[model samples]
Target: MLLVPRQLLRAGMTGDVPYYGGRFSPAQAYAAAHPQPRPAPPPPAPTSRADQQLAALQNLFAAGVLTAEEYQQFAARVTP
Candidate 1:
């Protein structure tokens, strides 16, 4: 007697399509037939007051001016 796994048996019986096996399934084929919409470009990074404060804190930490404890405290305060 030949035995197939339940998932394979179910897949075979049902009309549902497979994805990422080796070849594209019916859904994938259909999607490929129709062109997909492109995603919008990401917004520019913030240059506001909060961002400035964060940048200042980062610079201070990097410059070895701010101790670890002071950096942590400043980070906690500045982080919205």
Candidate 2:
């Protein structure tokens, strides 16, 4: 394994590494000045009133509060 001096490693980590002869690389300078833009995240899907009512009916059926027939009837009414 190649070994580097502790001071050199510290300077590199802290972004203060000295150029070979007081000169900055062109690519490094350009990259520091210009950064790419990130795209915005997509918006969340909106829930409809019918969807909320159906979900409530499903929860009731799952809890044994509503029979299959009643659940289906309520679901049908909740939707268009």
Candidate 3:
């Protein structure tokens, strides 16, 4: 038959007393008991027809297909 001291068992269960020369701090014990929550993933990127139209207008202006006045009119129509 073998017997262990209640105090030693209590200390081990509660991680209050150091064992084998290594101690468990309150923070470490709490962390071991409760883990931190993971951060939420970032939101997806936005997509809009206005963005596509703006890109198209820029391309058209660069290609000399649309004049300044035409670009302005197209921008006004496409913008929210």
Best by TM-score: 3
* Model 2 stretches astray by more than 4 angstroms: 1-47
lDDT accuracy of residue 33 in candidate 2: 85
Superposed by TM-score, candidate 1 places the C-alpha of residue 67 at a distance from the truth, in angstroms, of 0.9
lDDT string for model 2 (3-61, tens) is 99888788889799555666668877888789877788888776687788899899999
Ranking by lDDT: 3, 1, 2
Worst 10 residues of 2 by lDDT: 17-26
Worst 10 residues of 1 by lDDT: 12-21
- RMSD value for candidate 2: 11.2
lDDT of 2 at 5: 89
Off by over 4 Å in 1: 1-47
Tens-digit lDDT track for model 3 on 1-80? 44988897898797784554466677788898999899999998876777998999999999999999999999999886
Candidate 2 has which clashing residue pairs, if any?
Answer: none
